[model samples]
Every structure is written in structure tokens, then in C-alpha cells.
Target: MKKKLTGKTALVTGSSRGVGRLVAIALADLGCSTIFCHGRSEASCRETARQIESRGAKAVILPAELSDPAQVESLADRVLAAGGVDILYNNAAVMHPWRDSPEELSFEDWAWSFQVNVFALVMLTVRLLAPMKLKKWGRIINLTSGIDKTPQLAAYGASKWAVDKWTDDLAAALAGSGVIVSRLDPGWLKTDLGGPNADHEPEAVLPGALVPCLLPDDAPGGSFFRAQELRNFSLD
Candidate 1:
């Protein structure tokens, strides 16, 4: 039988490592024909690209610094030029160092966190939305977090809150438009961002990470998915 996403194209940001890299490879294995692996530099995504190809999918490396608005726009422009993607996985994010006191967190740290985690993600989403609407089919998965009450990581937590709000609003607007936008929490994993103290391995993000992408066309938008909750779930 043909795979669910056969012939579909997808873009997985921050895919050079960690959760994004694993998700990108999973998408390829599920039959996404063209997988755009994005990272901070082309070299960073080479291994990801190789893995995608090994899974029988073509990989295109697109590099951009999410902290820079110009680079974000350029990244979106390039993807649009190549004919927009069918699935968009906004998986890139940044976290500020934990400050013993929340008051000690610098404004610059908060600014940088929001710039990469929220602003850049929204910029890419809106820019690529038109094509999806026109085609009447698209899946957008925005990565969010479950961090709470940890003032030490307030900057990161606040940024994720902003992502949740934006995702909710966008989903409402796209209702009945055939473009689905949802937020996904990959849970605490032992990735660079998740740190070594996290509860699960990065590999545990699979199956659950791919859940939103495989939702039915009639599936409602603005839903929250937790990868850990679906840890033992099967796509088949």
C-alpha cells in the first residue's frame, strides 16, 4: 500500500539535530518525497539530508538564523519559490540560561528568545499560508512547551506561551480553509535544548510527533498534542 504522505513535501526547521532531525527522517520514511532540512548552516544539515535520502526521500538544506528577521524572511522566500510545502514543522527554538533569580534575566535574553521562538515562527507561517490556502490543504505543526512555574527559565516559557496564543488565533482564522494549524509539545527529552536531565530520549518523540501531520482533513485546528501521551501509540 502507498504511504500516507507519499508525494508530499515538508519543511522541518532546526532539523540538523535533536527532535527536528529525528522528525525529518520519520517524515521521509513515511513517504514525504521532498524534505527540506533546515539548520543554522548548510553543513549542519548534511547528515540529516543524507538520512532523508537513505529513507528514499530527496532532501533540500535551507539554513537560517531564526534570531535574525532578515534570514527568516529569506528562508520563507526560498521555500515559497520552490513551490510551498504540504507540511510545515516549526520545530526550532532557543532557551536562555537558567538564572537563579528571574530578576537577573537580561532583557536581551528575553528578546532573543522571542525573536527565535515566536516571531520567526509566525513570520514563516504567515508567509507560507497563502499557498496552503490556495491549495486548500496543508498541515502546520508548531512546537510548544509544557514548562511552568520555573522562573529560572521564564524567558523560554514566556516565548512558548506566545506561540500557543498565536497558534490558537491562526487556527481560528484558518477554520474550514483546509489548512490545519496545531501546537505540539514534544515533552522533556534529552536533546541540546531539553538538557541531559530531561526524562526521555529524543527518539521518543516519534509516532507522536507525526500524529498531527497525519490528521484527517476534517480534524479540528488549535488542538494540543503531547508526544509523550502517544508514546506507545501506533500510526498503523
Candidate 2:
């Protein structure tokens, strides 16, 4: 059988390591010939590209500070110059130490978190959605966290809530526009962010991340999907 994304080009943000790295590789294996793996550093992004290309696929490495809208615009322009983006997985995220109480969070920290976690995502989608619309087909999959499920953190959870709302509103905004907007929570995977005690491995998140990008046109939209249970309302 043919792979789901044989001719597709996927851009997996923050793909230097952890869940992002795994997701980029999985998409390549699924036949995404052009994989754009982005990172804060060139060396890291190059390593991700190496991992993807070793599997017999072409890849592009984009070094970007996603929090900066200017850099994001440049990145979007470069991608548009190269070709169309078929699948976009907005997976990068950051937060202050959870040890800090609500009152302890500085205004600066909160602002920075939103810029990176939410604003940059919106910019990327806005730039790419038009092209996707022109073609009348595309997938926009935002990588959200389980924070909304267990909300002890402030800035992090708030940003994800914004993402959840964006996916919902974007889906409605793009109705009849042929662009599907959705999110995938890869569970509590053990990584630098998830900590060593997390329930699942980093690899477990890939399939869940990949599923929403390949959702059928009639499938549910503005919803969340988890590896253990994929049906609607199971915020697992």
C-alpha cells in the first residue's frame, strides 16, 4: 500500500530532539519526501535532518527562534519559495518552573511564553493556510500538551488553552476552505519537559501526532486525540 504522505512536505517545529524529532522522522517514513525540521540552532536542526534523510528521504533544516515574529516571517517566506507546505505540526513549547506559584510568575515570563507558544504558531498558520487554501487541501496539526487535563502550571497551561481555542476557532473559520485544524496530545512522555517519571516514552507520541494530520475530511474537527483513546471528548 502507498504511504499516507507520499508527496507531502511536512514542517515539524522544534524538531531538534525529544517528541519533535520522533514526529519528524515518522512523517518522513510515512512518505513525506520533504521534511523541514526546525530548531533554535543550526547544528541541532542539521542533526534532525540527518536522522530523517538517512531513511532515504530529502529534508531541510531551518534554524529559527520561533518566538520572534520577524524570524518566523523569514522562515515562512523561505518555505514558500521552496514549495508548498502540506502538513504543519506546531510542536514547540516552553514554560517557567512549575515550582513557582501563580503570584510568583512575572509578567515578562507570561508574555514570553505566549509569544513562543501561541503567537508564533498563529503566524506560521496564517502564512501557510492561504497556500493550503489555494490548493483546497491541507492539514494543520498543533501539538498541544496534557496541561489542560492536569493544570498545576500557570503560563504553560494558559498557552495550551489558547491553542485549544485556536484549533476550534480556526476550524470554524476555515469551513469550506479545505483546511483541517486540530490538535494531538501525545500523552505524558518522558523527556526534558515531561521528566523521567512520565508514563510513556517519547516515541509513543509520534503515532498520535501523525493521526490528526491524516484525518479524513468527514472525520471530527476542532477536537483532541490521544494515543490510548482517539474518540471525541477523551482528553486522555
Candidate 3:
């Protein structure tokens, strides 16, 4: 049987591990033609590339420190040069160290979070939008957090909030344009950022995580999907 994304290409940021890694592999399993795995270093993405190749999909390792704007631009340049992608999964994010109080969060913390979580995401999305628009088909999934009332991680939460806002606004702008932009909250999984005590395992993000990518072109943009809620869900 043929797969869902047989002719499609994708880019999953932070795909070296955790939720990004799982999502990239799942896309490959769905028959994506090429999946770009982004990491801070090429070495970090080797395993993911191997896994994707094993599934008969080509994996390209694109390394860039998202915290740096120049690196983000370089990453985008590389992707565009490679002919862009049919799907863009903004899954990588950084969490600030928990502070005793919200007021204790430093300027650096907020800046760092915004740079990687918000600015970098926006830059990539904007740069890639043209290609998707030209083709009149695309999927943009921005991973967000359900974090709330936890002032200890204010910087992280605020950055994710910005992501939510960006998604909503972009969705509006891209409405009826054939390119759907939406948000996906992977829940608190036991990943590096989620810590060992997280409620769910990283694998729990599978099928549900791919929902946004598989949506019909007419599906509304800006929809929010929760991976945990879609557990045991069927894609067929």
C-alpha cells in the first residue's frame, strides 16, 4: 500500500532527539521523500538520519544553533537551497532553568527563550512560506506548551505564548491559501526538557503528532491539537 506522504519533503527542527526525533521518524514511515533533521551539530542528527534512511526516506542533517539569528538564517538558506519542504515542524524549544520566583528570571533568560523559541521559528516560517505558497500546499506545525501558572518557568511559557500568537496570526494570513498552519501541544512527555518525572513517555506523541501534517487542505488553520488526547487514534 502507498503511504500518505510518499512524495512530500519535511523539516523537523530539533529532530536529533525527543519529540522532534519521533516525529521525523514517523513522517518517514508515512513515506516522506526527504526529511531534514535539524540539530545543534551534525553529529547529533546522525542517528535520526540513519533511522529515516532505514525507512527508505532520505534524511538531511542541518545543524544550527537556533539561539543565534545568523545560524537561523543559514539554516533557512540551506533549506531553501535544497528546494524547501512540503511540511515544516517547529518542534525544537528550550526551557529556562526554573527560578524560585518569576521576578528572579533574568533578562538573559527571556532573551534566550524568545530568540530560539519565537524569533527563530518565525524566521524559518516566513522564509519558507513563499515556496509553500507557490505550490499552494503545505503544512506548518508549531509545537506549543500547556504550561500555565508556573511562574518559575515564565520565560519558557511566555515564549510559547508568543508561538501561539504567531500561529494564530499566520493562520489568518494564510487562510484560503492552501497552506495550513496550526499548533500542536505534545503534552509533558519524558524528554530532556520534560525531565524524568513527566507524565507521558516520548513515544506517546506519535500518531497524534502527525495529525496536523495529514490534515486535508481545506481543514481550517490555527487549530490546536493535543497529542495525549489523541492516544490510540487511527490515521486511516
lDDT (10s digit) by residue, model 2, range 1-236: 14777888888898998888988988887888899888898898877898889977898988889878899998888888887698888988876676446787778768888998999999988998877989878888887877754334788888988999999999898877778888888888888888999888887775567778777777656878775453232212
Q: In candidate 3, residue 5 scores what lDDT? A: 87
153-213 in candidate 1: lDDT tens per residue?
9999999999999999999999999999999999999999999999999999988999999
| Candidate 1's TM-score | 0.98
TM-score against native, each model = 0.98, 0.92, 0.99
Off by over 4 Å in 3: none
Q: How does each model score on lDDT?
A: 0.95, 0.81, 0.95
Which lDDT tens digits does candidate 3 get at residues 1-236?
13888889999999999999999999998999999999999999999999999999999999999999999999999999999999999999999999999889999999999999999999999999999999999999999999989999999999999999999999999999999999999999999999999999999997889999999978999999999998977866
Higher-lDDT candidate of 2 and 3: 3
Considering lDDT, where higher is better, how would the candidates rank from best to worst? Answer: 3, 1, 2
Clashing residue pairs found in predicted model 3: none
lDDT of 3 at 65: 98
Q: Given candidate 1, what's the lDDT at residue 166?
A: 99
